[model samples]
Target: MTATAELVVDAGRRIAQDHPESPLAIAGLTVRYGDKPVLFGVDYATPPGAMLAIIGPNGAGKSTLIKAALGIVPKVTGEVTLFGRPQAQERHRIAYVPQRAGVDWDFPATVLDVVLMGLYREMGLWRFTGARHRKTALDCLERVGMRNFADRQIGQLSGGQQQRVFLARALAQDAELYVMDEPFAGVDAATERAIITVLKELNARGKTIICVHHDLATVAEYFTHVLIVNMHKIAEGPVAEAFTEANLQAAYGGRLSGAQVTRLAGASS
Candidate 1:
């Protein structure tokens, strides 16, 4: 790791050295697709109750970082901890929202059915869902403004509506930590607003949100913490401190122009 690149591992450790019990802690995490390394020795820890945005250019492994931490993908090296415990033991406390495009929406399930899937872990797969369980599912949908569409087929909804339903499903888990892959990608303006509003409200209530976000313009407005990466971590900390011109240049390399960097810096400030 370069002196500059060491920021990838050290920045996260600096977040919580005295307390390794942060919401999520990753040490020396690495991923490789055969001989090609996707992530190289990334060390990161999420601040408790922070709405952190992990940002980087395409192919930066933003999604892979989260996936590896969540154990959705295999890790070539390093260890991941959630709430100071091994991930498998504490997985019940986590909620994950995968990329919208990855779901098979045509499976003849209603919006409510998808949200109820969140309860399968708690209710057991073959166990019947009682009225209370159904109520919890409805309340989750209501939180995301999808209660009216609960009976609608998942495949019939627009992209934004589908995103909202997924968000509701995550909410139904009642998890302490929510990790999402590009929650705002390709959504309409109103859906974006609704999503941000719900996320901020969750953060206010002490839920830790670690999201793989793409848009730099909304980093400051939507998140309190930022992690910039390009295979190796570039910068990470509270948004105001880490989302800077130098980090942007390092994370995106020559992809961002002087004017584009200037605009991002201005927005972040």
Candidate 2:
């Protein structure tokens, strides 16, 4: 086996023997663009049912970290496990929501059609979606308050509406763990509230959630745990403990200010 593969095997065994219930565990993860390293030996273990917020500045590899762990982007060296198994072995147990700007809104798919795509894994490659699939897709849309837009073209919707559609799609997947990249980016107040409510509900139902969050102000209010990163992990643990001014300074190089923290807290309330 490759060196990276061996690391993954060792990490998986260690995690199972130690943190057996951790929903997500990443160790010695590294990523590179050509020769430039983006993430270097990042490590984190997320507990089940926790709302995790990944906080970092631009170009800090926040999104890259998630993509690498999920195998959406190639990793240079790392070990990643979900529920004590390798990611490939537990693909169906995890759901990913990428940045909204990454999607081609002009794609010729309806809201319902996009949501139904979440079920493709369960449906297999050869089977067609039937009435049951449609119903489930519609129900997922309802949860996100986007059922009314079911038949609408995705490109015709507002940014928040488009985000809700994507959330519906992820919900339709019904995975135990959700990994999202900036779900709050560019969304309005109402949309943010709606998404948070849905996220809380999911957590209450025993799902683990990890979101790449840009707004540090809302970190304490929106997440139970925080992972501070800047190319490499700075700090990670309970929001009450790890989301401190000292850690923020270390991660963002003193960019976060006292006023910014107050504003973020006020915004969440």
| Each prediction's number of clashing residue pairs | 0, 1
What TM-score goes with each of the models? 0.93, 0.92
lDDT of 2 by residue, 1-269 (tens): 37766776567456544665788888878889898989987878898889999988999999999999999999987778888877899999888999999989999999999999899887977789999999999999999999999999999999999899989999999999999999999999999999999999999999999999998767877899989899989998888778776677778766767666545544444
Give each model's whole-structure lDDT.
0.89, 0.87
73-98: candidate 1 lDDT, tens digit per residue: 99976678889877899999999999
TM-score, structure 1 vs. true: 0.93
Structure candidate 1, residue pairs in collision:
none
| Candidate 1 local Cα displacement, residue 147, angstroms | 0.8
Candidate 1 Cα misplacement greater than 4 A, ranges: 1-18
What is residue 216's positional error in candidate 1, in angstroms? 0.6
Q: After superposition, how far is residue 197 of candidate 2 from its true place, in Å?
A: 0.3
Which 10 successive residues of model 2 have the least lDDT summed?
260-269
